[model samples]
Target: MPLPPDIRHGGNKACYSPMLDYVKLPTPEAFESSEDYYSTTFHEMIHSTGHASRVGRKGILEPSYFGSHEYSKEELVAEMGAAFLCGYAGIEQRTIGNSAAYIAGWLKALKNDKTLLIHAAAQAQHASDYILNRKRGEGEQIDEPIA
Candidate 1:
């Protein structure tokens, strides 16, 4: 399925701008592989779900300092959400290692807090579900907290 019209590409950096209600991604050729391109696009798309007009997650809506807990948590949500979307689309294997490494970096910055990881996973699931047109109760949950 194609992304919503509000999401667009063509930017030096990949980001979801809530103020603009849009997502801007770098060119596909900028990534190491097509999988990387899609994964990065998916990450930004996940960020868009936090817009007040969508799922309304505060992490993306509020101002947050770089490296702050809120910022780190949002990064976790975006990466994990993208990973979930990739897995659902059956492209996860191509990007799983990179996704794991990307997520691990954030985990380290967050001091390896298992509880935060769990919360982020839950939020990511919610965000992915939102993007995929799955209502909260319409499908099986896509992410389970790590034991």
Candidate 2:
């Protein structure tokens, strides 16, 4: 499938603003390669999924300091979600190592908490499902409880 229209634009950095419900991304040339640019954009797009209108993950809804536990966990969710999307889209190898290394840094800072990793991965899956327009289960009609 094609990228969401709003995510295909240009800038010098990529970010998701929950208040705006849109992703801002740098130009493809700004990154080492187009694949890297798409990878970063996918990360921000995952962040966008946490908006109140979507998956409604608390980290995006509530304010948290940059490096705080909540913020770090949210970062994990975005990275893992992006990695999952990349894999599903058949571009995983192009960015998996980089994504893994980035995720590892957050894991280290979180004190190597395996439980946190599990929770983040599950949230990531949900976010991926949301982006792909998948429902939690047939007729479930409710958000998955946040981890």
Candidate 3:
């Protein structure tokens, strides 16, 4: 996807472009291990779940600049979502600590607003469920805001 991001160094960062509806990931060789590659890929996939065609998340549809509050929140969701997916696949042990630390760093930067974690966890669960193709019952309510 996205030409394996810069054919040379193979992009250091993976991203999901909402406008283009594509996930840009680096080559597996660029990562320390296959697990790292898959974890990063899972993160981008979670970002894709926010596309309007999928979950219609405002943060994705509305377009926020990098480092914005919306962007940060969406990143948090993606990180947690990736963690959930990794756990489901029984590969989280290698990445969950990093994910938690990443989230904690963001939380600290955001002044440790406790509710942010709660909201992000809920949104991440929903996004992870979506990616796994798990549908809720017609009356079941699991639609949490993306930001």
Candidate 1 lDDT over 1-147, as tens digits, reads 224636566767888777887788887888888988989888988888777666667687788888988888989999999999999888999999999999999999998576898889888988888778875455653332221
Instruction: Put down candidate 2 lDDT per residue, 41-71, tens digits, no spaces.
Output: 8899888877766667988989888999889
Ranking by lDDT: 2, 1, 3
Q: lDDT value for candidate 1? A: 0.81
Error of 1 at 89 (Å): 1.2
Count clashing residue pairs per candidate. Answer: 0, 0, 0
Which of 1 and 3 is ahead in lDDT? 1
- Estimated TM-score per prediction? 0.85, 0.87, 0.84
Descending-TM-score candidate ranking:
2, 1, 3
Q: Lowest summed-lDDT stretch of 10 residues in model 2?
A: 1-10
Cα lDDT computed for each candidate against the true fold: 0.81, 0.81, 0.76
Candidate 2, residue 23: Cα displacement in angstroms equals 1.0
What would you estimate as the lDDT of candidate 2? 0.81
* Model 3 alpha-carbon drift over 4 Å, by segment: 1-10, 141-147
For model 3, residues 4-34, the per-residue Cα lDDT tens digits are 2122225767778777877877778989878
Clashing pairs for model 3 are: none
Cα deviation in Å at residue 96, candidate 3? Answer: 1.7
Say which candidate scores most in TM-score.
2
RMSD in Å for model 1: 4.4
Instruction: Provide C-alpha RMSD values for all models, in order.
Output: 4.4, 2.7, 4.2
